[model samples]
Target: MRLMDSSEAITIKDVRSARRRLEGSARVTPLLEDPHLNAIAGRRVLVKAECLQRTGAFKFRGAWSALTALGEGARERGVITYSSGNHAQGIAHAAEELGIPATIVMPDDAPALKLANTRGYGAEVVLYDRAGGQSREEIGNRLAEARGLTPVLPYDEPLVIAGQGTAGLEIAGQARAMGVTKAEVLVCCGGGGLSAGMAVALAAEAPGLRVRTVEPAGFDDTARSLAAGERLGNEPGASSICDAILTPMPGELTFPILSRLAGPGLAVTDDEVLRTMGLAFQRLKLVTEPGGAVALAAALFHGAELADGPVVALISGGNVDTAMFRRALDMLDAAEPGAA
Candidate 1:
């Protein structure tokens, strides 16, 4: 599917419309003031607790937007989509709430909690091997075609990206309510839908604000793509401790906007991600995945220039493996000069 062009794409206006459509369904998670986060970074740091969003991630905003955007006939046929995990749950939850059937093709390597949550919403689950060499897109497409289900993309479709942008749009409102007009907004970007949507929204609303993006270190495709001015795919098996930032390329729609609205996709290390994850829990009292922590990692390590940021680091998601979550906590424990 072709991604939306920044020039012709739906504006933040559309995103707000979607958010309104969601009304009371999707959570308008708190824009938390973090005194500890501020003290450590030596600058104001705010976090949009998207991890508190329905489905435990900002995916709820996009999933609900896309499902609600569908017409009666489209909803009748039901919807199918692929996800690393969070989007699957988002779509499934939306479909369940809307009384539509939903099916998802998910990676076997996807987080177990997300898998269970998706199923809990009554969506049918199909699993595929990440090592099978069969692409996730291909697996999802085949499943959709075979079942004659309408396949909703995780982040590629225009409507989907526009839906995802609602998070940023909401953040803008929250930022304003907090008596701030603009600050650098750091969004965690995988395939760019969320960042692109936010970029468009924040650019239109905040004007001078910087909508920066953060990605994992070894998987800095968004940063590279912005620099190269082209879509660049990921290297095969490029590993990151932040599994969610594994996408090789930015979306076509998300590229120009990211380059234009966001300064550049910032890259942060797994170590930094772990530190940020622990810090998020300790300071913000929030559950954040490694990918989610990338933005905070940038604020912690890169400070000052990323923003005089009354900055909203979009805490992307919270569904991390139990063992890995402990490891992240342990990393935090070992952070200083000695072991605990």
Candidate 2:
């Protein structure tokens, strides 16, 4: 079995098709003013709540759009995928909705809550060693071929990127209606799906706005790759508290468009993300996972240029554990917002 590459690229046509395919399925998460955090940044910040999306994350939009885009014959054959967490649950839930069987390969140390949720959606789970997790593409392709299942990639497909782009589309629409004209939209990065997608949609819809992507500092292969103007991988591996953003590099399907739309990339520390997550919970009364808090963290601490105007922050997910959330809050409470 051969591991396939992503679709050629992201385009307006693909985004439109994805929007049509996922119309009734994916939730249109809100983009609203977060006055409390706005005052902190001294900038008008509005958060796009992908955290409230179905499956508690934005992955569902991409998965559902991709799955629904499949031909009738392909849907009948079922689907296979590999994911550490969010994408696993997303593919599982999307597969269930489409009446397609799903087989998800997950790392053994993958969060139990996510693993259980994936299983609950009727996906067959195969746990591999976390330290030695092999090429997910190779594994997924093998299983897909063996069982005549369709391989649904998490971030490397045109349909997936287009679907994820809808988050940006919504942000643009809502932001404009709210009287926001010059926004700098920031989105968290993983394999570049959400950031890439949002960048495309934002470029198309909010042409004047700048779209920046934020990633976990050490695990920011996408940023490095974008900076070097080449496809680079996190050769050694990714180690970060924001587990979901630990992807190695940018997706083949998303690169061209991201390079076109996403002006540049930025990175933040795990501590910064955790601190932002605590701030989000306390100030917005929203539960945000570390992976989702990167955008907010960047704007709060590093967005000095846009620190005066309307800034749209995409809160990508909210799947943190209770204990972790409490601990992050405690630690953030202990930290000085400014200290020597």
Candidate 3:
């Protein structure tokens, strides 16, 4: 149980105390915007959505900020992790609304509607064998040490990266109430917990907002471990229909907070994440899930590696199924014949 150790010092006051313990238990989700994705990313894109959060994704604000910041005798001695489905239904619906007792460890090629909605939020899933290498974090730390439990680390801990940086503090106050002083956000990452917890809450509340991280192409190991500054790995059988951001590396505490607050990491292309999950269900109806449309497929096909302001992105999950949302509306009606 002595797990946390990547220097443990998450800041932005632990994402504003996990957004004041997720005010009324998380769900500030929407940010949307769409002028046909801002005229196809010529700028101003937005999106945040978080797959309409709540158990749909954004890993339930770091699984309810790591199980209500534990320690009521470690939430009654029950918890455990490892996921391949929106943090296993955000730690099985925040350990069944705090009654605790979870135990995910999924990935038998997950996404059977996220293993039946993580067993309909009752937890106790345990599948393993992700393409046979087999380790859902060593079978969720050997069944959380044979059931003593308490682990909730779906992304290098620190209260689950300050509960995924409270959705980057609600996307920096909804992109500064949409006046958006400056932008680039884009997240859909994997083991680098919500893009290193939204680049440590947009480097402390939108320092002209940055955070990047999308991924998919051969599980772009956090976009080549943020272009080889160190941590790298994903190639041993490398596969991806965007299986929830695929993770083969990038987490020893989310790579030094995504190499000191991210940017320069993007990869997309499971056919551009099924055409950005068919352009987020034909223009903002939203329902993404090829690993949440790889940050809106890098805000609609990597606009020349971005950098002129206004982007956002972050659709991070929607659970998807039904023949993969009918192959993402048949690849957005073969790339927009009548636009799906």
User: Candidate 1: lDDT of 114?
Assistant: 80
Cα lDDT, model 2, residue 128? 80
**Candidate 2: stretches off by over 4 Å:** 1-7, 235-238, 305-308, 336-340
Q: What is candidate 3's lDDT per residue for 205-232, written digit by digit as tens?
A: 8888888888888777777777888888
* Model 1 ranges off by over 4 Å: 1-8, 304-309, 337-340
| lDDT of the candidates, in the order given | 0.80, 0.80, 0.81
What is the Cα-based lDDT of residue 239 in candidate 1? 80
Q: Which scores higher on TM-score, 2 or 3?
A: 2
**What is the lDDT for 92 in model 2?**
95
Q: For residues 17-107, write the lDDT of model 2, one tens digit per residue.
A: 7888888888888886766677777788888888899988899998998888777888887888888888888999999988988899888
Q: Of the candidates numbered 1 and 3, which has the greater TM-score value?
A: 1
Error of 2 at 98 (Å): 1.5
Clash totals, every prediction: 1, 0, 0
